[model samples]
Target chain A: GESVGLHLPTLSVQEGDNSIINCAYSNSASDYFIWYKQESGKGPQFIIDIRSNMDKRQGQRVTVLLNKTVKHLSLQIAATQPGDSAVYFCAERIDTGFQKLVFGTGTRLLVSP
Target chain B: NAGVTQTPKFRILKIGQSMTLQCTQDMNHNYMYWYRQDPGMGLKLIYYSVGAGITDKGEVPNGYNVSRSTTEDFPLRLELAAPSQTSVYFCASSPRGRFQPQHFGDGTRLSIL
Candidate 1:
């Protein structure tokens, strides 16, 4: 069955260190990808997004790299902070549904101080 | 703006009970979605609406129903709630398709015992 998944279910990193989270998507037709962070007791928050036209996109302290050839996506967080502890998710737009978004299994990032 | 807002931040339902999850967006976005997050799993699309009076099934539509009466409101209905239905529910909205980012509300934690 077609699905999107994360390479790691959980990741632990020390504060001030950089963290890298990986994701794999199944649908090749998916052209748009996004990264989201979900804190405990809250909903997923938008982090960064990369369109197929670009292989990489950078944000404040985060970066999203897209490898369409392998259907792989990655999110890199720099200078990780204790506040960054949360489950991170990657999503794709399967098709145009007026900005509809599809999600992947999440990876919990534990920023240990 | 309030962005997206979900009602009943937390709810405990007995088996066979039913309830409605309310979602509203003040962004005037035309696209709204309902998603559920399970333990160790990613957010699964329960339903989505393209606009007022238009709704469609998503990746996981079983045991759930949704209706979009206006651009700002999209509600999800759970009938005969089961243990399997226990999860965190989220509501999100985007301006429209075309690679726009999404804004999410604080999720609703639902547990069926």
Candidate 2:
């Protein structure tokens, strides 16, 4: 079955440094992609999203880059902070009719102060 | 605005016990979805509702049921709970558009013994 996966299970970075997380998706039919941040004992929070038509989208200090040809997606965060320590997930909209999303295992980002 | 709210932040159930995880959104979103996340893994869709009186199953719907009687509410029911059902459940809602982002609730932590 088609699935979404992250290249790294965990990423470590120092404060004020730039951070990038990579994700790979198997479904070519997916048109929309999203990034979510989940803190300890909490739900996933919406971060940024990009559509197939657009190769990149930026929001606040975060940017989402999509490469349809490679079926790859990446999220870049600027000036990493301690509060940014959490699990990040990338999800793809698999079903357009009902807008179903398939999520990646997740990449835990640890920002050291 | 209480984007999305889930009841019973935590719960414990014995094998064969049944319970419902309640979810409601104040955003008036037309699309509601339920997902379960196992430790260290991504979320798997359990079920979703397009609108009132409309419901459908997703990737992992077995042993679980759902209903949407109104636009503001979508509850997930787990019957004959088993150890496999132990996970963190999250409810999310999105607007009418396919490209809209889904807003999530805090989540319900369930442990089945």
Model 2, runs deviating above 4 Å: A1-8
lDDT per residue for candidate 2 within A1-113, as digits (tens), equals: 23334343789999999999998986999989999999999889999999999999999999999999999999999999999999888899876676888888888999999
lDDT of 2 by residue, B39-93 (tens): 7677889999999999998889999999999999999999899999999999999
Q: Return the lDDT, model 1, position B93.
A: 91
Q: Clash number for every model?
A: 3, 0
TM-scores for all candidates?
A: 0.91, 0.95
Pairs of colliding residues, candidate 1: A98-B96, A98-B97, A99-B97
lDDT of each: 0.87, 0.91
Q: Give interface RMSD, per candidate.
A: 3.4, 3.5
Error in Å for residue B38 of model 2: 0.3
The interface RMSD value for candidate 2 stands at 3.5
| Candidate 2: residue A79 Cα off by (Å) | 0.6
lDDT of 1 by residue, A1-113 (tens): 12334354789999999999998887888878889898888888889988989999999999899998999999999999999999888888777544556677788899888
Candidate 1 wrong stretches, greater than 4 Å: A1-8, A96-99
Summarize candidate 1's per-residue lDDT along B9-72 as a digit string, tens digits. Answer: 9999999999999999999999898988776677788898889999998879999999998998
Q: Which ten residues in a row have the lowest lDDT in candidate 2 chain A?
A: A1-10
